[model samples]
Target: MIKVAVILTGVLLLAAYLVLLERKLLGRFQARIGPNRAGIFGLLQPVSDGIKLLTKEDVIPQGAHRRIFLFAPAVVAATALLTFAVVPMGPDLHLGGRKIPMVVTDMNVGLLYVFAMASLSVYGVVLGGWASDSKYAMLGSIRGAAQMISYELALGLSIVPVVMLAGSLSLVDIVDAQAGRPFILVQPLAFVIFFLSAMAESKRIPFDLPEAEAELGSGYHTEYSGMRFGMFFLGEYVQMQVLGALTAVFFLGGWRGPFLPAPLWLLVKIVLVVTAMIWIRATLPRFRYDQLMGLGWKFLIPAALINIVITGFVMVGI
Candidate 1:
């Protein structure tokens, strides 16, 4: 238990650095310098940000539900880290004469665990908006709920093909089976669908309708401040990292590469995916809520279904 706790702490710390990396990368994407003013090349920006948020004054809205407001951010942050417990960071490694799996849990129903965690995470959004006692928060929360639910269905259908091909739900097994060939080649369409949907599920770019600044004023988190807001901020970036890692694991072939150790391969794949996400954010304009919904249900979901059908047919013939 202590070991699990320690590893989790390390993962959270890594997530913090990831947010800083995203900002710096975004700066490079936009042809501008980023946070090098903070510390040596801004390596310490996340640490500075963490300290600022923690020491800032806590603010509750005039009529906000104080207890619910306080609890919502914590819930989101906790759930985001929990999903990583099942992700295989590397092949099994020997530690002190006992082998420890890189992942925290090796469930037969690993994919299902991800879906379940996603579903439960909605409470954080719903609570955050309701507890804020503000119209903007409510609207943002509603947008978040609708967006997540719509994208998740497509995300699930898309990945079903990979699971079908591998004949297993264990993440580690899926990676091992993709030793030479990545799932991206077998299901490129599904790969596109999953990547886009995961972005929506994480409330990132084109799909970040909930946080659309022009319309929502910081969205569902408008009323949160201090560590309450910090938790949500951390949760968002961690969610991004988790989603990027999932893209690598299920499609890009987790921890599989030539001339690189398993952990390095996994990290390299995840960083590329994360950079692509940054590129998308830098290049694409935010989608209207209606347009976002239409793309997910009218396009992505059906496309994923078709991909699954084709995959099923191919596997049967083989």
Candidate 2:
């Protein structure tokens, strides 16, 4: 219970600050200033933003399905937080002759658990859009549903080689398999597929068709307000961090570094991955819907499948 509380608190705080980090980075990318008024260098901007959201009016559209509308954002936030339960941050602590694993629950099927959570998160968008009773919201949700489902195939397939190499679905086991060397070295293609698929899974930048402001008017959560809206906002950032951590676990040698503590190494890897994500956002325009779907279905999926076959053949030969 203590571990769960600590993890949740840490995730929320990190997610809040990540927004600030993205803004700061984006400001630099665009040659402008980010939030600089709330505190020293806008360090406290997230706090103020949190306060404002908490104090603001929680408004539901008149025609909205009150129950589903109210519940949707929580779905998004909760799933993202729950994903951390199985993510091992470092080596287990040995205290008072007792072993405490770094992860909340080191399930044998942790990878499957992660995908289940990702699948569940889609419901939040679907429910929010459907309950809002707005055409734009519905369209956005439909797009999100299609996009997520399409990319999820590639996302799952991309990791097949890793699973084959590691011979386990457990993330901890996968990390252990990479002790001699990171998977990125041997499975660059899978890493690329996973990286691109993860970006799409997180609905970042080029894959952000669902929330295309010009087309969808704030997308699935168009009718949300106050902390309800904040929940959805928080979910996106948390998912970003989760995906970053997964990337680290799968390819970057989770927590393994020469001079840093294990946890710090993991954190550094995650931040690097996240920074690249933000940079991609700054540089790439959103993909057209057809183009997005085509890439996921036609390209990433087939590539992942072929990579898996090649990996299988190599393993057999060895």
Candidate 3:
């Protein structure tokens, strides 16, 4: 119970600040100042934003399905948070002669659990958009769902090689397998594919066709406002953090580094992965819808398949 509370609080706080961090980085990338008004360097900006969202008027569009519209955003936020349950941030700690694992729950099928939660988040987008009774919202949700589903295939495929090499689905076991060297060194191709696919799955820029402002009018959340909309926003950043953490767990040797506490090492790696993603968001343009689907199906999927085959051969040969 204590572990769950700590993880939930930590993840929610991180998600809130991640928005500020992205804004600051983006301002710099654009050669301008970011949020420096709310507090010293806008340190309290997320707090102000939270207050505003909470106090703002929550609206339900006329003719909308009120229950589903209200419920959908929670689905996204909940699934994203739940996915963290199996993510081990550091090695076990011995306290009072009791062994405490770093993760909330280290399921043997941790990888699959993560994927299942990710897959469930799509329903929030679809249901929210559909319940809104807005054509724009419906279109955005459809595009978002299709894009997420398409990229998921590549994302799932990209990790097969990692599982083959690790010979276990448990994330802790995967980390243990990498003690000699990170998988990024051995499965470079899988790493690249997984990274790209993850960005797409998270609906980051260049893969953000679903939320294209000019086209979708703010996309699936077009009809959302106040704290309701905030939940949807929270889900995106949280998903980014979740994917960043997964990337570290799979490729960077989770929590493993010399001269640092294990959890701090994992935090450092997650920040690096997330910063790179923000850079990509600032540097790249949204892809044309066809191009987005094409890259996932024609390129990433095929590359992942080939990588899996090669990994299998290497494992058998050695």
Candidate 4:
């Protein structure tokens, strides 16, 4: 219980700062100043943002379903935080004559659990949009659901090769399986597929058709106000960190490196993945809705299937 609390607090704090980091990086990418006024180099920017969100007036539309509208944000924030429970931050540490695993929980079906929680997050978006009683919100939510469902297949299939190699669904086992070398070298295709699918799943750029502000007027959370809206924002950034962690665990070799500590290595890998994601956001244009669906269903899904079949045969041959 203590471990769970600590991890939850840590993840929330990290999520808050990640928002600031993204803003700063995006500003630099766009050749403009970021949030440098909040504190030295915008160190206190996230704190300021939090206060503003919390202090803002909470408004509910006249026709909105008040109960579900209020509940929806909780679903997003909760599921995003829950997915981190099985993620291993480092190897086991010996303390007081007992070994303590770095993860909050070590489940045999950790990977499945992560994906399950990810799928549940769509409900929050859908419900928030529907309950708002707004056409734009409804359309955005529908797009979010379809996009998530489409990319989710590719996301699951992309990791099959890793599961095959690791011989276990446990994330810790997956990390351990990479003791000698990371999976990226052997399963580069899976890495690319997983990364792209994950970006879509997180509802970020190039795949952010659901939240295309120019078209949908802020999308699913169009009617959300104050910290209620902030919850969705928080969930997105936290999910981004979760994706970074998963990419590190599955491909970059979670918490495994020489000279440096295991946790630090894992952190380094996550930062690299997150930075790449940010760069993509800065460089690429958003895909049209049809283009987004086509890429996921036509290209990524089939590619992942082929990768899995090839991996299976190679394993059988070996």
Candidate 5:
């Protein structure tokens, strides 16, 4: 129970810091100053934001489905926290005369664990949207479900080559295979598919159609207020960080570095991956809904399937 509490606390802390990093990165990229007033370079922005959300008045729509509405944000946040359980930050290090690995729970079936938890996370958005009894919320939920399901097919298939090559579904084993040579080199197409699908799954910039502001008026969580609204927002950013960590574990070689200690190495790799995500967000414009759907089905899926076929033949020939 203590370990669970500790892991949960750590995840919350990491998620808070990630929001600051994203803001700072976006500010720099856009040539506009970010939140420097709250704390050091707006380091206190998250802190202040949390306080504000906590103190704000809670507003539940009278016509809304009350039970599910109360449950949605909590479900999303819990799912985000659950994923970190299997995320190994580094090798065991001796601290205060005890060796401790920086992961929560590295189950034997790490790959399936992540996929299962990831599938569960989408339900929060769908449920929240439907419970709101608003057109925008319904549309947003529908879009979220369709988008997640569509991309997950390609996303799941694209990573199969990595599994086949490594001959293990364990994330730790996958990292081992890419230790000396990153998977990005051998499976370039898979990397692209994994990356794009990851972006869609996380619902950032180009793939964030469900929450499109101009069209949907804040989309699914528009009816939510107070800490409830905060949960959804924070959960999205945390999901971004979690997905970035997964990318590091699967492709960038998790905690595989020299000179720096293992934990530091893990942090460095995650920062790089998260920075790239922010860069992509700043550079690309959001895709139209229909265009987004078309690209996923027509381009990404086909390319990922080809990547798998190519990898199979190459492996058999060898």
Candidate 6:
């Protein structure tokens, strides 16, 4: 219980600051200053943002389904946080003659648990859009559901090679399997597929068709206000953090590096991955809807399948 509480609080706080960090980095990428007035270098910007959201009027559209509208945001935020419960942050620690694993839970099917939570998040987006009774929101929700479902295939397939190599579904076991060297070196193609699918799953950058501002007026959350809208916003950043951690664990060898504490090494790898994401966001233009679907179905899916076949053959022969 105590461990869960600590991790929950820490993740929430990290989600808030991640927004500030992205804004700062995006500003740098665009050659402009980001938020700096809220606190030194905008260090306290998230605090101010939180206060503003909390104080804002909570409004609901008259035609909206009040119950579902209110429930949607909570679903997104809760699922995003819950997905981290099984993520192993570092190797077990020996304390008081006992070993303590650095995770909220150590389920054998941790990877499946993560994917299941991810699948559920789409319902939040769909409900929020449908409950609003707004055409734009409905369209956004449809796009979101379709896009996520399409990319999820690629995402899951991309990880098959890693699971094959590690011979376990538990994230801790997967990390341990990489102790000699990270999976990125052995499964570069799978890593690329996973990274790209992860970006799409998080609804970032080129894959952000669901929330395209020019097309959908902020997409599924168009009718949300105050902290309700804040929950959706918070969910996105938290999901990004989750992806970064997963990438670190699966490809970068979570918490495994020389000359540094395991947790710190994990943190460093996460930051590097997040930075790359930010850079990609700055460089790429959003994909057209058809283009997005085509890439997922035609390119990423086939590539992942072929990679898996080759990996299986090689492993079998070896």
Residue 110, candidate 2: C-alpha displacement in angstroms: 0.8
- Give the alpha carbon lDDT tens digit for every residue of 1-318 in model 6: 888888888888888888888899999999989999997878999999999999999999999999999999999999989988998888888999999999889999999999999999999999999999999999999999999999999999999999999999999999999989999999999999999999999899988999999999999999999999999999998898899999999999998999999878877887788888988999999999999999999999999999999999999999
Candidate 4 deviant stretches above 4 angstroms? none
Q: lDDT by residue for model 5 over 199-297, one digit each (tens)?
A: 898888989998999999888898999999999987887787788788888787887887998767877877787788899999999999999999899
Predicted candidate 2 versus true structure: per-residue lDDT over 1-318, tens digit per residue? 999998888888889999999999999999999899998999999999999999999999999999999999999999999999988889889999999898899889999999999999999999999999999999989999999999999999999899999999998999999999999999999999999999998899989998999998999988889999999999999999999999999999998889889888988898899999999999999899989999999999999999999999999999
Task: Please write out the lDDT profile of model 3 over residues 1-318, one tens digit for every residue.
Answer: 999998888889888889999999999999989999998989999999999999999999998999999999999999999998999989999999999999888899999999999999999999999999999999999999999999899999999999988999999999999999999999999999999999998889988887899998989999999999999999999999899999999999999999999988988898899999999999998889999999999999999999999999989999
lDDT of 2 at 176: 92
* Model 4 Cα lDDT, one tens digit per residue, 1-318: 888988788778888888888898999999989889998998999999999999999999999999999999999999998998999989899989999989989999999999999999999989999999999999999999999988999999999999999999999999999999999999999999999999999999988988899999999999999999999999998888899999999999999999999878877887788889999999999998889999999999999999999999999999
Which residue runs does candidate 3 get wrong by more than 4 Å? Answer: none
Q: Candidate 3, clashing residue pairs?
A: none
Candidate 5, position 95, lDDT: 83
Clashing pairs in 6: none
What would the per-residue lDDT of candidate 1 be over residues 1-318, giving only the tens digit for each residue? 765786677668777888888888888988989899787999888889999999999988889998999899988988888888788888887979999888888899998998888887888998999999999999999999999888999999999999998889999988987987999998899899999999899988878898898999999998888988999998887788788789989998898888998877887887788778888988899998889999999999999999889999989999
Once superposed on the true structure, which residue ranges of model 6 sit more than 4 Å away at CA?
Answer: none
Q: Of 5 and 6, which scores higher on lDDT?
A: 6
**Model 4 worst lDDT run, 10 consecutive residues:** 263-272
What local lDDT does model 2 show for residue 198? 93
Candidate 5's TM-score reads 0.95
lDDT of 6 at 285: 99
TM-score of each: 0.96, 0.99, 0.99, 0.98, 0.95, 0.98
